[model samples]
Target: MATRIAPHEMPMIGRRELVCLIALMMSLSAMAIDGMLPALDEMARELGAANGNQRQLVVAVFLLANGVGTLFPGSLADRYGRRPVLLGTLAAFAACSIAVALVHSFEALLVIRALQGFSAAGLMVVPYAIIRDQFEGDAMARLMSLVGAVFIVVPVVAPSIGQGVLLIAGWRWIFLSLAGVSAIGALWLWLRLPETLHPEYRHEINVPIILRNMGAAFFNRAAVGYVLGTSLLIGAVFGYVNSAQQLIGEHFGAGTWFPVVFGATAAMMVLSNIVNSRIVETFGARRVSHAGVLLFMLVSMVQVWASYAHPGELAWFLPLMAANLGLLGFLGANFGSIAMQPFAHIAGAASSIQSFFRMFGAAVVGLVIGQAYDGTARPFAFALLICSVLALALVLFSEKGRLFRRLNGPVRQEAE
Candidate 1:
């Protein structure tokens, strides 16, 4: 029998186990995206990609479908329960992985990849909902930061893992490996995760209720602002991801070094999350994130100047990229935590709506940036500058021009 527990109940596992479980669940999507980076060239050649840029559609389409899929899981999880919905999504994700391996054409593969992303959206949404269910404000942020600290390892090593798979077998084996991983995650979650959605908090899964809840999230000024800011920041990250391979491999002549550079930059994000976990509780999310966004804009400006001055120079570009990613790591967990703070009663819907717009909008911007790749880092650098400025503006507007004001709440001291 399933363990039925209230949303207010603590997680069944120990602290370390909880962090690992949450990180593993979230890593499903990252592994899917980052692991495919190394195989893009081989996959493109075999699948009849129309142009070098066209291969980017493989990543962009998955993100789009993942965003669209975010619209439903939150409401479903609210109505039914988190555990069941997550289990079903993980099963579908595994199935999609298998289907991807059997596909022949690029178009067919893209279709399956979209389905895979759609299924993976549950992993994206429900975990945040679960986090909100049990914690609030800085406590939640700290928990998320820790989860992110561990989760960031997936992206750091995923490209290298994909490269290893390429050395020994076809790219299809990559998806096969993902399937195995998803299956194991599903099994682990089923055995260990307790139900967190309290019965009293459950909402009806109807059109009217869903629309009303979504409107509530959209109209909440703080939630909307953070969501928009998070979207713009994510757009910049997507832009980088789409261009990194080309910039490093083609422009810098580092095909074999792509994974090393990417992994090193990803490590910066992990380090930032570790720092965030330590400081977010004492200084507050707003204070830390405000400083982060401003620093991000400044760093982006430097990147724009550097790109123009030293075109194709890895020495200048790599450090700047790491700094930008580090700032992003600061924004991600904080933004999500703040945006959902006011909507804890509707965490599922709020998380869904926030992530849908964030991922979907970012995918659109990233797609444009990816297609604009012209054997130079100028476009990528410029996109980062614009995205940072826009994000900072949204954040300012959200806070009513107030940068680091902490919201009124009694700080809860969480046990380690």
Candidate 2:
């Protein structure tokens, strides 16, 4: 039987363990997207996909599905329980992965990929909801930082893993491998993880109640602004991911070394996350996030200028990309925490709705930016700059132009 401890006696889960669990959950999402990168060309060729650009649709479709899926799972978790809902979602995700691996036609694969993303709603949203269930204020910031730190390792390593699989077993093996990983994750949760939400804390999951909660969340001016900000920021990130391989392989002549260069930039994100984790306690989420938004905008503007000046130099291109992505580590965790702060009572529903908007909005923006790819980095740079500007505007508007406000002093702190 699982060990039981009173709520008060239960030790605050160690930062390492919490980060690992959340990171593992997040890795599931990254693995689904990144692991398929190296295979896009081969999959397109084998499946007879019409346009070269259409290969990107495989990734975009999944993100779109994930966004649509996010809306329902949170309420389901709130009503049923986290563990059961998560398990069910993972089961569906695994089955979809298997289907994706076996499907022969590009259209069928696209359909399966979308379904796989839809199944990922639990993986994408629940972990944050779980973190919110247990933490508040500075504690939540620290936890999110640690989670971000753990997450940093995923993007760095996931593409390399995908490339390795492609070298040995072909692209289909990537999905097969993910299916196996999903099964293990599901079993681990089934065997060890306990339900975090108490029976008394459970919310009713009627359509009326869900619509009311969603409407309230959507109508909140600050929440809506933050949600749009997150979406635009993530849209920029997805735009980069969708085009990174082609930009590196075709434009920069990186070829199979594409993953190596990709991973190098991704490593910079780890450092940024560590920095965020350390300073968030002292500087507060609001201050740090505000600063990050400005820095991101500056970096993106610089990238746009750089791309315009020296469009073909990999040396100039790579560093700008690294700096751009590195800043995202700072933005990712803090935004979620800030957005969810006011909606604590409806953490599940709030997390779900916010995640849905963020993912769906990003998917749409990213897909458009990606389709504009012209065998150059200019499109990516332009997308980043536009998104960054919008993100800054939203942040400023959301905080009523007081984006620079300090935290209400530091509270209890934790180790980074």
Candidate 3:
């Protein structure tokens, strides 16, 4: 008999190939935010955004747009092909990046920024949808983990990269850099990436069908619950991203070193990703993610107390931020996988709807929490705590109160 090779055993990606590809796709989304960090102050000054905190609206709006974008691109990828949709979105994103860089007024920037976000929606969801298309089971988890590890490096290094550009050129160049990067990504995809959606399995896109699929995803008890929970998690993360600069720059008086501390905190996410990748197969995503949420909740409470107790110390603040972000790496990938697992049949529509809700939810949270910014870390801490509690509640309800039953063994059943 001929020997049969397992899917995982097949040598598909060359060395660093997977990481580079994953990083490239992930960077499309991360650069949208990371590259803008250093430019925030300059942009605010140039555009005359009202308050220092109000500048964060640029980041929040983009995230919300990303959520909205995620909804449709998935279906388009499923219908037409992943390559064309991704390439189209990247070109759109590049155009918006240039627009953001050139715009002179705050109002104009807001509109352009939102469009940039809308463009990003395709970038954020399609990459994962592509991965899910190629791999599943333990292979899916491992690839996701590697992708998560590479994904986090953007946040770790992007701030410094942005700051470096700020030192040489003006803030406008930051957007230009993003535009250039997007163009490169588009070119790369055009050359190397192939269509992952098989013709036999592809669905025809229709208005009523999309609506029905979206409605089904929303009504699915497990899917809806996980989506809501994931939204809260994203909201908490957006709240932090919106306020991180202010907390580090104004509150801690870190000045130019703001990006350094921010990068450090972001780097901790890599640690969590490593842990998640190593254990997810052994422990299962459900067990790992459930524990991560509980851990996140506890850490948030501690952060709230610490921020209140010692209002002006980096020693107290950095550790708390690191721990909080580290746990998020574990929570993010697993939650997304678990949520999409039940909707594999309509992964495109499901991804779009879920992503839209998550991003839009984050925007609302970012806006509200950002308003509470008072030149202190207190608001960030409190917002995280509240969001964590809500996420925990949703996860519990989604699991039908059996959240921890999978901790000791493989989660043999679907989330419901």
Per-model C-alpha lDDT, please? 0.86, 0.81, 0.78
Q: Write candidate 1's Cα lDDT for 1-416 as tens digits.
A: 01122356666776678789989988989999999899999998998888888888889888889988999999999889999999999899989989988888999989998999889999989999988887788888888899999999998999999999989998999999999998898888989988888777788877887878887876677777889888888887887788778878889788899999999998999999999999998898999999999999999999999998999889998899999999988999999888877776788888888889888888888888888899999998899999889998898888898999987654322110
Best first by TM-score, ranked: 1, 2, 3
* Residues 1-416 of candidate 2: C-alpha lDDT, one tens digit per residue: 01121332253555467668667776887889987888889999999899878899999999999999999888888888788888898889889988988999998998899999999988988887777767766567767878877877878888899989988999999999988998888876776566776555578867888777777665577667778898998898888788877888888888988888888988888888888888887787778888888888998888889888988788998898898888887888888777776665566787888899999999999899888999888888888888989888888888887886754633221100
Relative to the unseen true structure, what is the C-alpha lDDT of residue 153 in candidate 3, on a scale of 0 to 100? 88
Worst 10 residues of 3 by lDDT: 1-10
Model 2 steric clash pairs = none
Ranking of models by lDDT? 1, 2, 3
> By the TM-score metric, which is better: model 1 or model 2?
1
Cα-based RMSD of candidate 3? 3.7
Can you list the residue pairs that collide in candidate 3?
67-356, 70-352, 71-352
lDDT of 1 at 266: 89
- Choose the strongest candidate by lDDT: 1
How much RMSD separates candidate 1 from the native structure?
4.1
